[model samples]
Target: MELDLLKEAFDRVAKKQKQSSSKTLDIVNQIEKEIEQAITKIQTTSNHTSVLTELKDKLNELAPMNQLDSNQKDINLALAKYTKLLEKCFQPDISRAYRNVDTDPHVLNEIISTHFYRQGLFDLGDCFTNEAREPNAASLKLPFVEMYQILESMRERDLEPALAWAAKNRGPLTQNGSTLELKLHQLQFVEILKKGNRDEALKYARTHLARFAATHKGSIQKLMACLLWAGRLDQSPYTEFTAQAQWEELAHELARQFCGLLGQSYESPLEVAISAGVQGLPTLLKLSTVMAGKKEEWQNMKQLPVALDLGREFQFHSVFVCPVLREPASEENPPMLLPCGHVLSKQSIVKLSKSSTRPFKCPYCPSEATISQCRQLHF
Candidate 1:
């Protein structure tokens, strides 16, 4: 476009110099005539003008970088447009969210995480056993398996005694145990960490840690996650472990976060034990897996220090790790979750409609958290 315009301007200048003095006035008249003819031709054009339009667009797009103000505006505009495109392309896919539960014998968190892990929507796959393998993923147990599932459910609820009984009764996995239990029940004794009470979870963890120590590496990771969840860096041995037990890297972070959680959570070791030990571990495993797999999600998980701290606050309060979306509007009150990804008081749930906001912002995520994000991930 500039090239064409320059050529036209040069022609006009050259023609002006050659014109006679009398014709110099005609030069103005001639230029005016040409400009009028150009405007008329533009108004009369009916055929497709794609080539001219595209050329003009290309020139406009090639704005000079020396115009710093314009350059910044264009960059900002491009970023906003790109972000909108990403949100449109990657909105969460909940269609298959619960599709596998009927057959998989897994927690709801797992279903959501595994399906969306690749897309960075959620992550249950990252929840590793002390062995560093995905926990009870395929439900491959037999015989005492049914008992294990009950134990898992009880553990998910932080029911220490119930979980312990299942662990002790079923005994260790190496003692020639049978493997005919249904899918959910097949989760092994390591699920002890899936309990809410660290004391209860430890009961099972110590037993499994000792019994399965030789064969299963996951026992240690389970123990560590439980210990971390229990808020017991000072007490429980939280070894650094992950897919391969990188204790050195994880220990300092664990200790630092433990102090933070202890200061903020406001709960007892027993309370922390139960939440992080049993209910919380499973939730963490699932939630972290989902968060870690995503490109920018890990920071969001980091920002959720308050959520970790809240577990400490609920001493004597039973911490429930469930995978369902509903908070189970009990007989006493309806369901409600707080802005920080925790549950609201029953009174709050009952009066939520009267509250000022609709679809509130979860202090946890960049966007408003759905009830789905708050779903508990039971053992």
Candidate 2:
């Protein structure tokens, strides 16, 4: 409903702007025509007074300046109405005290520097580190610098650096089950074949792609068929191998593999976390408003009041929910598993145990277990 109101207001503003432009353009064209006629009359006629009087009469009839003024008024009125609608639809800020997740300023600065380095902004990262007196920034920048250089080369269709990196990290890449090296060689082979170098492409494939034949036999067979078409690979049965988009895809895969080998993620963790938080902020702000009257109840909440369904992409780890309390388990209230395989929060265990003296019944099962038998589970 709010989006509809916003869209309606936006449409009104856009319509008003277009109308104002059209009206101004029409008036300006009319004024120009009138001025041109007045100039022509002055140039041709000996009676300047009569020509000037006729020009003044034409100007009065056109009323171009008045038309512009009326258009401006319409535009301003539309803008004012749109602005009023925006103000009505806007949600006020939900002010709340910060709780949970204490972060060190130094560690945060390091993370920011690492993010900048990962983005190929060495100068900016260096400046930030120097200004903040961050040590070990150079160590963090080195690996990313090499990765960016290889990525840039890949963007230009050069695969030498990436091939060399692959060769150096062959053991780890193979261990991780990454087909990046084979994919890079396949791209190179296709590039050669596209240039009508069939024999050269075959030799290149034998030297590089042949190694992966045992694992990727089907892929190798497809590439081998591309040899028949040679320069006409685009029209061949294996047209997917000749696509320009494959190079882009391979470059991204190489970057992912390179980062993975270096014990890093392709995207910065800080970036992912912030993106997920921003996506959930609207829901959080709405919850804050609804729970405004219950200050103490929510202010002390270790977990979120409502579950933010951020989809699978943002779900990086497992989260246990205590069935008894109907809340997500946090560090302060961790999930404890009984011998019978039922999980409940530590607080719930305490409540059901009757102060540790009696046995507690598992919510999901009929089995009873003492508090001492329950073990904490980690995500």
- The TM-score of predicted model 2 comes to 0.76
Give candidate 2's error at residue 39 in angstroms.
2.9
Taking all chains together, each candidate's TM-score versus the true structure is 0.16, 0.76
- lDDT at residue 263 of model 1 (Cα atoms): 39
Candidate 2 regions with alpha-carbon error over 4 angstroms? 45-65, 92-149, 261-264, 268-274, 295-297, 322-339, 344-363, 368-379
> lDDT (CA) for every model shown?
0.40, 0.85
Backbone clashes in model 2, listed as residue pairs: none
**Which 10 residues in a row give candidate 1 its minimum summed lDDT?**
178-187
**Model 1 C-alpha lDDT per residue in residues 59-167, reported as the tens digit of each score:** 4554333344443454555555555554554334333212122454345433433333322222233443212444554332221243334434543533343334434
